[model samples]
Target chain A: MISIHNLTKQFGRLRALDGIEAEFSAGQSIALIGPNGSGKTTLLKCLLGMARPDNGTLQFEGSDLTRSDTYRARIGYMPQIGRYPDNMRIGQLFDMMRDLRGYPENVDEELLDEFGLKAMFDKPLRALSGGTRQKVSAALAFLFRPAVLILDEPTAGLDPLAAEVLKAKILRERNTDRVIIVTSHILSDLDEISTHVLYLMDGKLQFFKDIETLKTETGESRLGLAIANVMRRHANENQASA
Target chain B: MLAKYSSTAAATLPFTGEPDGVTCAEKKARPVAAMLKIAKYVLYDILRNRIVLGYAAFLFVAALTFFNLEGDGSKSLMSLLNIVLIVAPLVSVIFSTIHFYNSYEFIELLVAQPVSRRTILGAEYAGVGGALVAAFLFGIGLPVAVFAPDARGFTLLVVGVLLTLVFVSLAFLAAVLTRDKARGIGLALLLWFCFSILYDGLVLVLLFAFSDYPLEKPTLVLTFLNPVDLSRILMLLQLDVSALMGYTGAVFNEFLGSTLGVALAYGCLALWVLLPMIWAERVFRKKDL
Candidate 1:
């Protein structure tokens, strides 16, 4: 479980995360939804201990993640855009990452073969198409069976089939005492799997609640419409309070 | 229940094994493995990279041809050594600067991994230095080995490696300071040009301007601060060519050409390598990456 208290991060005059407090328990999947510059990425990095919070503490399973690296081995992160050495072959890159994490060489080669990457085994990453690169990124994220998986725009460049395959993978892992936090602009892609949604507005975590409750509260079946309705209500409430 | 459905779901997922097989402790921790993996790719990538190949080949052919046409074997050796000493550091600085700039994406990917920043920096330095040392060993080492065939040849190799480390350290300092690739490249090249050309020119101008006074000793003290000049003096002193190196070595000999003094000079050169590296690592530890 991840626990964040009074998390605040700022870059000069711009405050990215402002004294945010939240808890993410195991077996829970959260979809972080927000517009551009809403501090979604900043909050995720703080959880991963990749970014420093000026005025808060983040704890993973009662241990401080900021002070130690022990929590990292249990987590897997995939950035919005996967960056790799252009000179590395697909197979070589996977092997290297696997070795780094010290996971056994027994990776799920199903994705490698599904994408026909085996044929392009020796080809440098610079030659692969954007979709293929995303395939590699997705494979690396799920390969280790990490207890915590943090994916940023996990399906950005993927085709429908590959995207479905990745989403299915995230769902399967979440059922087995793992916590999955995904950030993406595509709400439908996450609709089936996201158990809870954390809405962010202007760098503030507006709310964290179950998806079913959100749908019932907003009276919308689709996640996109439900989110819009919630935002509209929040804006109206803010106006009344003001 | 989700338990029954979970098994069915697992089968359809990308990885189908039972999660029970591996716990976190069951897997070995190999932080350096990521770095080495990346380093291997860097080596193969740059080795096959046409631009690096062409640049190295051009330097080799140009150096050899110039030596062959312009002078005798000993004179050629001297000229070639001088050429590599001057050109090698600049090339190392430029090549490493470009490599670091170009690999920004890869750097980000590595950072996102459960890897330490130290391993990443170490691996990159090793990879870049390895590429350069390989080129130098072949480009300059082989020629000196065949021609000089003495302690001077071996010393030249050591000097080349030291020079490579120095520039690599400095380049890393530049790489860690800025995020803008163009600005980083510009600053790195400026550093190189300053060290290689402008600084020496400036020193010469100072010595010439202050010729009426005892500036030779003062200039020798100043030269010790630049690794290039120190390496050159060491090489010349090693070759017993101090006479040709002019009065700089005379002053250096008076001050540091003795056994203890040479040891101290080498110690100072080694410190130059360590100081920059230590600073780079400190900067990296606090960096946002």
Candidate 2:
């Protein structure tokens, strides 16, 4: 479980994440959605401790995120674009990650097998295509069977079939006692995987609601259409205020 | 079987289900070991790098050529000294800057892991610094030892090692200061140019501008400021080439020729290797990936 309160981050003149407050508990698959420069990535960076906040407290499992790195052991993160050492082989990369995580024996190799990555064990990371790299990122994110999984654009570069496989994997993981947070521009890809939709606009939290509630409130059956209606309403309100 | 057992074990745990069940104390004790693991991977990556290998090969061949050209061992050492002073630092700073920028995304990935920022940066420094030190040792130190195994030769090797480390630290500082790769590399090159070239010119202009003033103590202080110059002075003094350096050389000999002066010079060089790394680590800790 993660709790964020009044989180603020500034990049010179740009206030990337401003006064963000949210709570994510176990078994909740949150879809973090925002427009470009809406601070989605900044919030994720703050949660992961990659970027320090100007003001706020981030607590993981009731402990401050800044207190120690042991909290991160429970969080498995996959970057939007996975960049690995160019010279390292796929097997070596996985091995190195295992070694860093202290060689967890009960590793999840489902994604690895589903993506057929074991066959390309000797292939260097640089030689892999973007889709394959996405697969590797996906596999690594799930490898440790962590308590929390933060996946950024998990299905971006994946093919339709691979994306479906990943969506199915997310659905299966959702049944477990785990917390999953995902951010993607592809709303449809997140439609079935996410239970809650967290929308951000201009570094401000516009709404955080369950998908069913959002659908009912907006009177739209589809997640994408529902979000579009909300965004339109917000834009009209902003224009009227201006 | 192990996966099933671990899953059941995790479910039995009280509050949070840590699959691996790594305790807080175990986690705290693993930072050093984790840093070394990361360093090992980085070292392996760098070892397989064609450019670094080429750099090492270039030094080895160049040193061999110098020894072949100059039949006199000291003369060859002098030639190799120039190479070590200029080319070694240039290669080290540029290589380190480029490596840091290239590994930027990978570092972001690492940041999201359980390791602390301090461990990641320290591992990076150790990996890159260690690789370059190895390159210099095998490249230049090996040939020098083979040809001229004297005290002067050993001093050259020491100077080469220190300059490599100092430049690596400077390059890391430059890399952490700017997010852009081009700007970081440019800053690194500027640092190399300032210490290796411009600093000496500025010192010469100062010496000429105030020729009337007592300048020996000031010059000695100035020499400690640049690692490259300090190394050159150390090597030159060790070679006993003060006769060619005139009055200022004798003054340098009077000071640097003493035991305490040599110790102080080495101490300053060690500081050169440390201060920049510590400063860079501070910047990296608070840096936005």
Candidate 3:
């Protein structure tokens, strides 16, 4: 579980994350939805400690994440754009990660086998296609069997079958004591896996609700339509009030 | 509790194999072991790069040629000294600056890992610096050892190693100062030029203006300000050129004759390496990756 209190981040003139407050508990798969430049990625980066907050506290299980780095050991992150040493082989990258973590027992190589990644372990990362690289990132995220998984656009570059494979894995972990936060522009892709919805627009939290409640409230069963309905209602109210 | 994430029966579901007890010991070794591993990987990766490989080959060929042409051990040391004073530092600084720029993604990847900022930055410094040193050791050291086996050979080798470390540290400082690779590289080149060329020119101007006064001590202090000039002075001391036995030469010889002076010179070189590196590490720690 993670808790954030009034988090703020600024990049020169742009306020990337503006006093955002939220909490994420285990046993729920969260769909983080937002438009372009909505500060979704920035918020995720703050959670991973890649982007330091300008003001406020971010805590994991009652302890501040900024206080120490040991907290990251519990979270497996799949970056939106995976950038590795181009010269290194796929196998070596995995091997190096395993060496760094030294948690061989915790590594789940099921994705590697499922995606046929183990067969091309000898290939250099630079030489691999983008889809293959995404597979590598996905496999590494689940490799350590961490209690939390923070995936940014988890299936963005994957083929249909690969994307479906990842979605199934995510859904299977939905009822377990694991927190999976996924950010994706593809609403249909996330609807299958996400149980809870956290909508962000322009660095502010629009709402956080269970999937069924969100659908019922908006009179729309699909996530895409339900979210659009909320946005339209807010826009009309603002226009009429103005 | 453990089977909370599993879909299958608790007893049959496949997951992490190790029980919880063994992880405690593994966790303790994580930081140090991880840093060393990163450094090792970096070193190996750099040594294989075409540019570094070319640099090593260039050194070997140049050292071999100079030794063969000079024929005398002392003469070869003098020529090799000039080469090391300029080339070693230039290559180390430039290569490191470019390497850091090219590997921006690599740093991002590591930042997302379960490692501290201190560990990541520290490992980078160690990795790049150590690899450059190893390249110099084999590329230039082997030839110097073969050509000049005396104390002069060892002295030249030490100076070369120190110069490599100093400039590589400076490169890190340059890279950390700016986010833009072009600007960072420009800063690195500007720094290299100041120390390698402009510093000596300034020293000459000072010498000319103070020709009326005893400027030996001022000249010596000025030399310490630039690592390139300092290493050159170290080389001059090792060579002991008798033809330049003027007041300044006597001053240098008399001072360098003592053990304290040698230690002081080395301390200056060590400071050159440490100061920039410490500054870079501090900046890197606070940087938003």
Candidate 4:
């Protein structure tokens, strides 16, 4: 579980995350959707301690994550664009991550096997295509069976079959009550896995609602159309005064 | 089998279902292990780089050529000093800067790991600093040790190592300051240029402008300011070339002629390495990946 309070981050004159307050609980499969430059990645980075917020606090299970590294052990994060050491082989990279985590007692390798990363052990990360790299990222995220999973665009670069496998894994984890936060642009990709939706626009939390609640309220069954209708209303309201 | 056991345990134990991170906290990854692991990877990556290999080869050839060209070993040591002064810092600074910028993705991935930010940064500094030092020692120091085994040769080696550390630390600082890779590299080169070239030119002007006054203290201060100048003075003293050093060298000789002065010179060199290191660590702690 993670709790954020009044979180704010700014890059030069541009504010990336503004006064964000949110919570993530176990068993909640959250789909974090936002337009470009709306601070989705930045928010995820702040949570992972890659980006430090200017104001407010983020805690894992009531203790400040910024204060300790041990708290991070429970989190498995997948960056939208996974960047690894170019020269390192995929096998060595996995070995190093496992070594860094101190050889956890149990590591879930479903995605790793399903994605067939084991066969590409000799391939250097530089030689791997973008989709292959995404497969690697997805595998690592699920490797630990982490209490919290922060996945940024987890399926963006995966093949259709690989994407389906990942979706199935997400659904299985949701039933097991593991916390998985995903940020994705593809509505259909999210519709099956995510139970809740948190939409962000211009660094603000436009709304947070259950997927079914959102669909029912918007009078649209499709997640993408429901979200579009909501955005359309927001745009119309803002444009009316302008 | 292990997965099945874990699944069964999770199902049977209500405590495992609790959201508290402390209950089933991972075996903490020791900071030392984290640091060493990262350093190991960084060293492996750098050693294989064509640039680092080229750098080491260049040093070997330069040292070999100079040693053979000058019939007398001491004469060659003098030439080696100048070369080491110019080449070591240039190569170390630029190489470290580029390595830091190029490893951006690696750094990002590491940042999200369970390891602490301190471990991440400490490991990075150790990694880069260690790799470049290795390059310098093998490429440059080995030849010097073989050719000139005296204290003077050893002094040159120490100076070379110190310069490498100083420049690498400065590169870390430069990399941390700006987000753009090109700008960061530019800033690093500019820093190298200022210390190696511009700093010397300005010091010369200051010495000339105040030629009439007793500039001993000021010149001494000035020499102490730039690491390159300090290194030059140390090298000159060791090579027994006080006559070519002119007035400032004499001033340095008077001050650094004693054991205390020698200690102070090394202390300053160590400080040069330390100041940038501390600055870089501070920047790294707060740096956005």
Candidate 5:
């Protein structure tokens, strides 16, 4: 479980994450939805301690996130664009990660088998296609059987079947005491796996609610339409206030 | 609870042979062990790079050509010294800057893991610096040992190795100071230029402008400021070329030519290697990857 308080990150004049606050508890698959440049990635980066927050505190399991990196042992992150050493083989990359994590025998490898990545284990990372690279990232994220999985645009470049495979894996993994935070533009994909929705607009938290409550309030069964309905209401409210 | 879920899923989907004993608590090695692990991978990557291999081959051939053409050990050493002073630092700077930029995404990936920033940057410094040092030793050191094998030849090899590390550190500093690849590389080149060429030009102007005064100490301090100059002076003193350098040369020969002076010069070069890397590490720790 993680808690963020008054998280603010400023990039020059643009406020990427403006005094945002949220809490994510275990067994909650959070769908972090936001438009482009809406501080979605920045928020995730702050949580991962990849980007230092201009002002705020992040706590994981009652411990300060920025104080030590041992907390990351529980986190498995799949970057939006996974960049790897060009000449390293897929197998070598996985081997190196396993070695670094010191968990050679405890890896999941479910996504690896499902995606059939083992067949191309010898191929250099630079030779992999975009979808294949996505598969690699997904597999690595799930490899450690981590308590928290932060995936950024995980299904963006996947094929339909691969996307379905990843979704099914997410669903299966969600049953455990794990917190899966996924950021993707595809609402239907999230609808299948996510239990909670955390929406952001202009670096501010628009809402953080359960999917059922969001559905009932918007009177829309599908998440895409429900979020669209909420956006429309917000836009009208803003215009009237102005 | 995790085992129960995995077992339930296992009934439908075949499980990989891994046991159902996955725990949230991870076992990690000590910081140095982790640093070495990352450094090993980085070293392997650099050793396999075509550009780096080509650089090694180029140095070997250049050393061989110089030795064969000169036919005299000291003359060949002087030629190789120029290569060490100019070409070695340039290659180290450019290659290291490019390598850092190319591995930007890889660094991001590593940062997301359980590793500390110190481990990542330290591994980079060790790996790149190690590979370049090995290349210099292999390409130039081997030939000099075979053809000359004198104290001056030995000093040349030491200077070459230290210069490589010094420039690599400078390159990392440049890379960390900027987000843009072009800018990083430009800054690296500018640093190389300042140390190798501009610094010498400024020293010459100072010597001419201060010809009326006893400028030996200031010029000696200026030489220590530039690793390239420190290396050249270190090697030239060993080559016994102070007679060609005039009165200041006699001063340098008297000062840098002694045991304490040599130790001080090497210490200055070592500082050149450490200071930039330490500064770069500080910048990289809080850097937004």
Candidate 6:
């Protein structure tokens, strides 16, 4: 479980995360949905302690994640744009990560074999297409079965079948007690997978609730429409509060 | 309750196999392992890289040709080691510094993982240093080794490794201090210049200005700060040719007279490896990814 209290991240004069407070419980798959510059990435980075909040405390279970090894050990992060050393072969890259984590033999190598990655193991990562790179990232993310997984743009650049395979893995993983936090511009992807939604707007937490409730309240079944309606309503509510 | 407590403890702690009872004692080792991995990759990459390979081959051939043609083998070998001590560090500083800046995205990705910042810096520094050392050993050290395989040869190789680390540390510091690629590289080059070239120039100016005074002790004292000079002195001392360097040798011999003094000089050389490295580690820990 992760708890964020009074988190405020600023970049020079620009406010990135505006004193947002929220808690994400275990076994929950949460979608961090927002437009560009909505601070979705910033929030996730703060949680990972990759970005320092101007003022806030981020806790994993109970310990401060900002400066502790315990929190870092329990999580796996997949960046939106994963860049690898160009000359390294895919198998070599995996081996390097395995060495870094020191859990090579214990990790599940079945998915890698199943996805035909075993065949392309000797291929240079630079020569691989975007979809292949995405597969590699996905494989790295799921390899450790980490307690918590933070995936940024998880489905980006994937083929339809590959995307489905990843989505299925995510769903299956969630059936267990693992927590997943995902951010993406693809509404339908989150709609199909995310149990809860955290909608961010202009560096503010607009809402955090069950996806079903959001759809029901907005009178829209599709996630994109539901999110749009909620934003409109949130604006009107803010005006009334003002 | 005992069962529950045990289960929670088991869940929270993986048996580290290390005596520390920290599941991550091995995890801490991962940084060194990761660095080795990077070094291995750098070794392969640089070896296979047409440009680097070409440059290395060209230098090897040039050194061989020069040695074959040169009349004075000792003088030539000494000069070559001197050039390597000076230019090898410069190359290591520049190449490794540029590599760090160039691999920002790669580094950020590594930082996002469950890795300590010190591990990341160490791994990167080690990786770059390993590659440069290998290149130097093969490209230059091999020639020196062939020419002087005695204590002088062995010491030259040791000096090569030390010089590699000295420059690698400077590059690391430069990379940490400035985010701009050009400026970071410029700073590293400036550092190389100050240590390798300018500092000696300034020392020369001072010695000239106070020609009448006994400046030998102070001059010897000052050489400890510049790793290049320290390595050069160490090499010269080992070769027993301190007599040839004139006042510089007299100053070195007068102050660093004893075996303990020589050991202390090498100790300072080793500290050159530690000081910047410790500072770089601190900078990296607080650095924003």
Taking all chains together, each candidate's TM-score versus the true structure is: 0.86, 0.91, 0.91, 0.91, 0.92, 0.85
Worst 10 residues of 3 chain A by lDDT: A98-107
Off by over 4 Å in 2: A239-242, B1-29
Cα deviation in Å at residue B192, candidate 6?
1.6
> lDDT per residue, candidate 1, B97-196, as tens digits?
8888887777777666655566677778888888887777777766566556777777777887888888888898898888788888888888878877
TM-score of candidate 1 to 2 decimals:
0.86
Docking class of predicted structure 3: acceptable
Measured by TM-score, how close is model 6 to the native structure? Answer: 0.85
> Where does the lowest 10-residue lDDT sum fall in candidate 5 chain B?
B4-13
Per-residue lDDT over B129-177 for candidate 2, one digit per residue giving the tens place of the 0 to 100 score: 9999998899998888888888988999999999999999999999999
Better of 1 and 3 by TM-score: 3
**Pairs of colliding residues, candidate 2:** none
Tell me which of candidates 3 and 6 scores higher on TM-score: 3
lDDT of 3 by residue, A45-151 (tens): 99988988999999888767765565566678999988888889999999887777653564688899999998998999899888888999999888877778999
lDDT of 5 at A195: 95
**Which residue pairs in candidate 3 collide?**
none
lDDT of 3 by residue, B1-289 (tens): 1211111111112223222343454544555566788898888778778777788888999899998898956787788888898899899999999998877877888887766777777778788888888888888899977778778888888989999999988999999999999999999989999999998898888889889999889877887788888788777888888337588777777776679988898899999999999999878877888
**Clashes within 3 Å, all models in order:** 0, 0, 0, 0, 0, 0
lDDT, candidates in the order shown: 0.75, 0.86, 0.83, 0.82, 0.86, 0.76
lDDT by residue (tens digit), candidate 6, B200-275: 8999999999999988777888898888988888887766789987986877886566788878887998899889
What does candidate 5's lDDT look like per residue over B187-212, in tens digits?
Answer: 99999999888988998898899889
Model 2: per-residue Cα lDDT over A1-242, one tens digit each: 78999999999999998899999988799999999889988888888888899998998887677645556767778888888878889999898877776676788899999999999999999999999999999998888888889998899999999998888988888855788999999998788899999999889999999999999999999999999999899889989999
Q: Find the candidate with the highest TM-score and give its number.
A: 5
**Against the hidden true structure, what lDDT does model 2 obtain?**
0.86
